[model samples]
Target: MKALLPTGDPREPVVLADVPEPTPRPDEALVKVEAFSVNRGETFKLEAPAPGDRPGKDVAGLVVQPAADGSGPNGIARVVGHPMAGGWAEYAAVPTDALAVLPDGVSALQAAALPLAGLTALRLLRTAGPVLGRRVLLTGASGGVGHYVTELAAAAGAEVTAVTRDAERGARLIELGAAAVVHDLADAPGPYDLVLESTGGPSLATALAKTARRGTLIWFGQASRRPATLDFFAFFDGPESAVIRHFHYLDADTSLGDDLAALVRLTAGGRLHPEIGRIADWADTATVLTDLRERRIRGKAVLTLA
Candidate 1:
């Protein structure tokens, strides 16, 4: 099977190569991958190795063979989490418990883009508390996770305000259900019940300031490549409250199948829609990684196995 491997060198870590096919264990299913998407973690792993590791996490495909334990449903599965070693490949073996059946009306490419970003958005929204009739703010509203967050919040009856630097993308944000869109945090009206912060650095502080009193602020990503630092005094003295929380999609109690099921349902019912940036052949994995690293693409970039 052909796979993309990380070489541990920042400049040239991701490369396409022929690798041995994965063997499914008793509790795992062997999926003939149809599509997979890239995430920031994958890009970071390639740029800087944490001890020993490979990239690629999200996967959507058809199950060629079910686990010996028969854990998957109807012999079809969507795998996520654990950053399996062969996502950018022709086939991958994933735990049957970690797989979910793709929803009706959702394409393989779209299903591949949902696992990571959708789960993260769901978790963040849950952390933000009840959204009924509340105002929510979303930074990086044009990114993969942001789009899901925007739609979910709106569907929950929250008035969503999306922040984006690009006016063109801002329109798309509003179309996704945001009540309003702004070029920056400064331009957005404040006192939001919840703030979904995706970009770090200055945007984190900006999000904190706009949060309503006792509001929750969930910081999920640092796409700016800078650490978040805020003044404690300002945070404590402000009328709007703040809570900084990180969204880790792979927590021990998080069931991949359950999350994927929820996402699949939403997509199947037309409640959640993923905005895919580009779709390329699996062999072009390196090019996709490069585009992600350089921030040249928006939404999700997926690779479909030919």
Candidate 2:
């Protein structure tokens, strides 16, 4: 099997090599990986390289064998899930409990893109608010997680406000079900029922200010690579009080297959759109990683194992 690994040098973060095939554990199944998605975490991990360690987490492929304990559905099936470290490979050993069997309508590419970003969006929405029938605001509405958040929140019957730096993409977001899309937070009013904040720095402050009195704001990412400072008086002596919560998505804890299964069903039923912004052969893995790290790609970038 071929796997992507860190080179232990920040200047040269990743390298590809022939590695031994993974042996499945009792609760795990062997998957012949077809496609996988690149995430910001993979890019950030490149900063501190670890030699011989596989860096990816998301994969979608055909299950070659079932778990030894038969904990999940039986037989071979197309599945989407997270591998502890070896997802960026031709094969991976994934825990059966974390796997979601993809329906016939969902492609390997689409399934690969959903496990991380889709699950993160679902978990964040659940942690913050149901968002249904509420005034919801989502920042970074053009990124991988943002697109899912925008579409899913809207699908849940919420009045969704999507914020993106690219005003041109706002139209597509509205088509995804957001009530309106704006170029920045200033264009949106404060007191939203819930705010999903992805970009950090100034955007964090904006989300904090825009959250409705007693509304919930979930901050998950720091794409801006800057710090946000807050004013005590502005927060405490404000017209109303608000709660700002931080979020991090760990597939092991956050996903028990329910959310991914629902998302897979939504994709299969045509109610949810999968945003695969870029697709390339595994030979182009470095290029895809660089594009994602530079923020040049809009949504999910998938690498196919040929």
The number of the candidate with the highest lDDT is: 2
Model 2 TM-score relative to the real fold = 0.94
lDDT of each model, Cα atoms only? 0.78, 0.82
Task: Please estimate how well model 2 matches the true structure, expressed as its whole-model Cα lDDT.
Answer: 0.82
Candidate 1 has an lDDT of 0.78
TM-score, one value per model:
0.92, 0.94
Candidate 1: residue pairs that collide: 213-240, 214-241
